[model samples]
Target: MNKFAALCLILCAAPANAHPHIFINAGLVFVVDADNRLTHVQVTWEYDELYSLLVTEDMGIDADYDGVLSEADTARLTGFDMQWIEGYNGDLVGTLAGQNLTLSAPTAPTATLTEGKIVTTHLRAVSGAPQINGTLSFLPYDGTYYTAYDVTLPVLVQGGNGCEVTVDTPDIKGALSMTKAEIGALPEDFDMEAAGLGDIGRRFATDVRVTCAAL
Candidate 1:
């Protein structure tokens, strides 16, 4: 498989059920410098228990059924190559001042099983420091609809002077309806790749808008 396909398999493999195979409750922490310029974003994803079990079993972790995957287990699992595909626009999208913000490669990726759930965290640095004068919008989703993203926490802004943040979550129902309608309008034999299925999910994703007050 190609690099993009391999990465998609881990995160966006479509099942026959017409619904997402994995469900993720996600949260974001926006890291800013003292000058109120965005620096990095910390993302946390919590997976459902069923998916967690599948991941543990597939990765050959929790060998003794001890409920906890060892440090080695965590390391091995985290070692999966998740680097951004060069031509692929990643699942996470961000914009500031209506201009797209480039998110660099992910760092400090960690995965752990806790309370029957798998939680992972990764930090991605913004390519450049962009001051958030008004609103910063984010959408996280797998375009194939193979994975669903639901924001579980407010957007946290850390280390920005005089910056207060408010998170506005989009309506899931409305977004879902929009995606379904768009997909349904396609021809029965429509080619997914040609139709850009890999970029469709964002249209239905719940937006995470971080609006800040004047500094």
Candidate 2:
């Protein structure tokens, strides 16, 4: 199922001069094993009320028309984990020791409607997770900027000791403005691949880094 399209039903609402039709408040919790190797990332995405309303109407969440999410409502929406499609990496990119970490299918996925908002949580296993030594960083963003992820929670380092985590919200205002200008200047028939602006979304991401002292 195309979760992105499902979440974004009102495509025409997107501004013509910019992207992000929907807004999400995201939180991340880093999971590590006893050996201090990164194992998984627990992600919580709280969607805006408007998109949540769309989900309830379109995804059959409020099946009973009760205006409340029940166990059955959440059960029906289980396994709604967004999948990588058409070169889209679900807007989350992780790296360990400067090497990209491959992400597996999300596990323990769940969804609920609370206070007129849709909240989803899942665990993304870190395939080939490196032993934590210096840094583990992640960049979350949508390539087309269809959804803006605002990560508000502090990165939690769990099941590991002597580790320090810091979040760097890089100043991307200049770079992103430049990228938008470049994209706007492109000819209608120009190929983005030829222009090499394909990962332009990364310029607007918040960088989360984890560093630990010697174990």
Candidate 3:
């Protein structure tokens, strides 16, 4: 929790050499027909883009989603999302089908954890028309490459209805845990003029992806 607060303070300052930790909240609604199959998804990942210092650098270390895992990479994850989180031109790999989604290393966003590797937190899937809000970070690595995602998403979680998870195993890497008041109470200087964050933190949902998930 203290770390989360510190992150907010640093972001409010927008220091140098810091990665942009941002939340490009997308409203994802998985649609299915009478049968269980992925039909459509309403994605809106571009909302109230802010200067998340962490989002800028942490997600950039491994342009490749292979998760061999790296200690050095974890160190670099610090002080990220404090500046300007940029945008990219890529898409998440996993597929979502009728109340369920699939995640795998060989697929799009299984998240292997090596220098460029990822991990399989292993949990995916949800119940009918679940309301989803996620973030995307534009992170570049080795000073020239980049990637994006909602590091917040977990592998396995209690079904939104509080039932034990049967399928859709969730991976909890980098999925921070905090309370709503804790996050909202974190110190921040939402002055787009002072922080120079453009339209950030101005109109609630219009600027950042909030309100829905936490409620």
- Count clashes in each candidate, considering only residues at least 3 apart in sequence or on different chains: 0, 0, 57
For all predicted structures, in order, the TM-scores are 0.80, 0.83, 0.24
Better of 1 and 2 by TM-score: 2
Q: Rank the candidates by lDDT, best first.
A: 1, 2, 3
Candidate 1 wrong stretches, greater than 4 Å = 1-18, 81-84, 178-182, 191-198
Residue lDDT tens for model 2, 1-215: 24233222322223334445788888888888777888889888888999888878887778676667777777877666565456556678988789889877677888877788888888888886667886889887776555777788556888776777888775555755566566556565665557875555567688888876667
**Stretches > 4 Å off in candidate 2:** 1-19, 63-67, 83-88
Error of 2 at 157 (Å): 1.0
Which residue window of length 10 is worst by lDDT in model 1?
9-18
Which of the numbered candidates is closest to the native, going by highest lDDT?
1
Instruction: Write the candidate numbers in order of decreasing TM-score.
Output: 2, 1, 3
lDDT of each: 0.73, 0.72, 0.29
| Per-residue accuracy of model 1 over 1-215 as CA lDDT, tens digit each | 54244324433343322356688888989998877789999988888889888878887888777778777988886735365678555578899978999987788998877887878888889987888887788888877666788887556888887666555565656655555555557665666677676465675576777765566
Q: How many backbone clashes does candidate 3 have?
A: 57
RMSD of 1: 4.8
